[model samples]
Target: MTERACILDTAPDAVGGALPAPAAPAVSSPESAAPAAPRRDMPRERLRTAGASALSDVELLAILLGFGLPGHDVFEVARTLLAQFGSLRAMLDAPPEEFEALRGIGPAKAAMLQAVTELARRALAQALDDKPLVDSPGAVEDYLRLLIGGRPHEVFVCLFLDARHRLIRLEESSRGSLTRMAVYPREIVRRALTLNAASLIVAHNHPSGAVQPSASDRRLTRVLRETLALVEVQLIDHLVIGTRDTFSFARHGWS
Candidate 1:
């Protein structure tokens, strides 16, 4: 089989180029006939011999990254992405086609990474949406995790409940920029009244991955509680979902 062309092979010829060449120090490379290790030996073999759980995150991701530049290896590519984005969650949540712009990363590899990341996301959403009434904190965690766990955007949702606390309506309350969201308490209560809801639960994502409520969050929730109290509908809880954790205002005695 023919070996694939690497970046060096695709560069303009040093001697045949139209422009004048600059001086550079000479370098030596290894012999061309040297034996090489198969890609299937590293990540794939580790997975095969040790099972998927036994592989480090870098090794597993290296399997997904597949290969790398001529002088670099797949683990280096995986490490590059990790270093660039800070975490696998950030890498998956980054804007579409953004990661492709990284060095040594091409469309094929980028597409593979995006597809696998999205596949897991879609599966999680499907699983959550198909489930029955979610009443417990665990269910809330599962549902919110699916929605906000790995996202790069800020999204707010309101789950309406009847007198029995059964879910009646699930609506998006707001979507916002990286650090701020626009919310109107009057509008939220008005929507709750329109839905004939007896109570409501609120959730929003912290793209910065800090689920702790900001002063703004507290002020908004206080206003929401007072407004909803006047109307007789209750504000049950306000949840902030971070990348790896979540914060519940109710747990902290906010609601």
Candidate 2:
């Protein structure tokens, strides 16, 4: 029998009906068969291989911002944020609304950015609570800056300290307009007495970004220092916080 006839005769014996055709084998192409290449230089990878300190500001922020909106990626979003704020410090000081206004940053992302500053402030606060201000002068200044440096209005804050100069509590003594604020010495003394604080450090912010103490600032410091002295609470320092710098009355021999 012919080969085609022989095959047909065998097929009929295997089943009552004709058999269905088999599917063609899948063809393998170089591009289709190869696995995706691993990314070595992404922010997460670099952060894992190297220390966090080794990452740039953009990379650090990109790690915090895990993902971005449809059109923008995390790296692009981080770059835009840094460019808009000009510095990491400025970004830390930004309000949540500012972050939310960005295209890729919604309420959740805004809260994350705002939390960064708060977390830093709380960490420094914990340090102060554990150690004396004398041992952590830089931490004290940093804490005050984070607390008030970016305020649009003037704010007077007091850090009540124990006999060892460890922080007992921090409170806002007064709040005012861009250029003026009312601070009551008696009220501060009363609060210190109530808290049984042994010493205190006071701070205020200049909305204009100037660290120089004004004539009023000097007078207030003098009065507050003398008033606290009467109540046996030593005034350790008075700090004037600006956006970029801090003026310490004690450091400048004004205390």
Candidate 3:
């Protein structure tokens, strides 16, 4: 599966049928107070009538972010964010620090955005953890993409699997510079033994968004595959994760 397939917006408007918008604040005349007026032509009202899918990215974002800072409305803030990031996917993939640095998005709003992104990752991880990965190669690719696709630096990850090929655990094995990572096969072997994992799928992200493996990447894969085999733990696959795609060694005949 692609990165787009993995990211899900879990907000009420995005998922289930739209919920009713809250009543507008009561208006007070000089003589008496009047009942709250009905909201109209607003994002929430539009979502209730049309549906979340009917709303634009800005509308959805505005709803997710309840209000905006002084001098900026929620829609304006949402538009600013989309303009800065260029797309909804890129906005969600952005680090919390990036969001915090933007105008109209303070610490609270940034945290909310960060939480949504993390929720998407955890939800995908839960699905992968519940079933055998071999039955769904697409899910594995989706999970890996969300895990490391947006990182500025390289991250080496390990998906430890049980004898039945179900995911046992996912671990960040190592981290390195934007272009280079030092991964140790012996350490991986040790971890597999410790976890009693019968098989493993390893992956690393390319900060440059290139899925092609380098000479060093190929050498490491060969050494790690051999080392894991000696311990009777299968090296199921090695995936090179890019921003939009993944390169699977197993799918490519383990070359």
Candidate 4:
């Protein structure tokens, strides 16, 4: 007999608490068997035959996850991931551990997904490499969403840029609670100096997925700017990315 999932409605994507992993979805009895999946072409096959542009969201993700299980179907899993996290962009931004917490996600798949996600992020970062300047908050959001928006915890990352405002490094400064994380100003300056970065864009996530900066967040940006200025690194922006929304300090002129 297949083990029934006793787990409740605890979300696979939500942060801050642990929930039992649900058993893979299964039929109640052997009499009524689930039907065989239809013979739709695989995403990669279609990508090769038709093109990547022709594949749907589930197809793309199915290609990413590689294979589906007997109980939990690949398409269902992909949809669950999107529903749990919110969107394709957000799901791509989610951390490894968060992905691991899901029922069917194993270490290998987690590693694969994490590696691919970071690769995609760095690809986006590289796209910014040829740009000459940071002139708008929208540009900043495009950058942040590619890296930090859907993460489970509060990851304080600093995007260090060169004098021309081109990319230098995407550094994770701290990793923990969104409500409170220690980001040292002295260390920030030290790292910026060591990296020879000319400007900075700071970002953190709200696991609540609100993206609205709190009073403390505003205050933290001010401190980081002051410290960076002492060492001559300009503070360009602060971004907060959440599943449901995003907040930009540059747009509001926070610091």
- Which candidate number has the best lDDT? 3
Worst 10 residues of 4 by lDDT: 3-12
Global lDDT for candidate 1?
A: 0.69
Provide the lDDT at 143 for model 2: 83
Lowest lDDT block of 10, candidate 2: 4-13
Candidate 2 accuracy as TM-score: 0.77
Deviating ranges (above 4 Å) for candidate 1: 1-40, 48-50, 68-72, 130-136, 142-146, 149-154, 161-170, 194-198, 229-234
The candidate, 2 or 3, that scores higher on TM-score is: 2
Q: In TM-score terms, which candidate is top?
A: 2
Ranking by TM-score: 2, 3, 1, 4
Q: lDDT tens string, model 1, 1-255?
A: 543211111112111222222223233366532234664366688788889999766778887766576667666677677777776767776765787678767777777777886787666545544344344666767667656766666777888888877777789877776656677677788899898999988888776666666666777778778889999998888888777678888889994
RMSD of each: 15.9, 29.0, 11.7, 11.0
How do all models score by TM-score?
A: 0.68, 0.77, 0.76, 0.64
- Report lDDT (Cα) of residue 163, candidate 3: 94
lDDT string for model 3 (162-209, tens) is 999998888998888766666777888999999999999999887666
Deviation from native of the Cα of residue 210 in model 1, angstroms:
2.4
How high a TM-score does candidate 4 get? 0.64
Candidate 3, overall lDDT?
0.78
The weakest ten consecutive residues by lDDT in model 1 span: 5-14
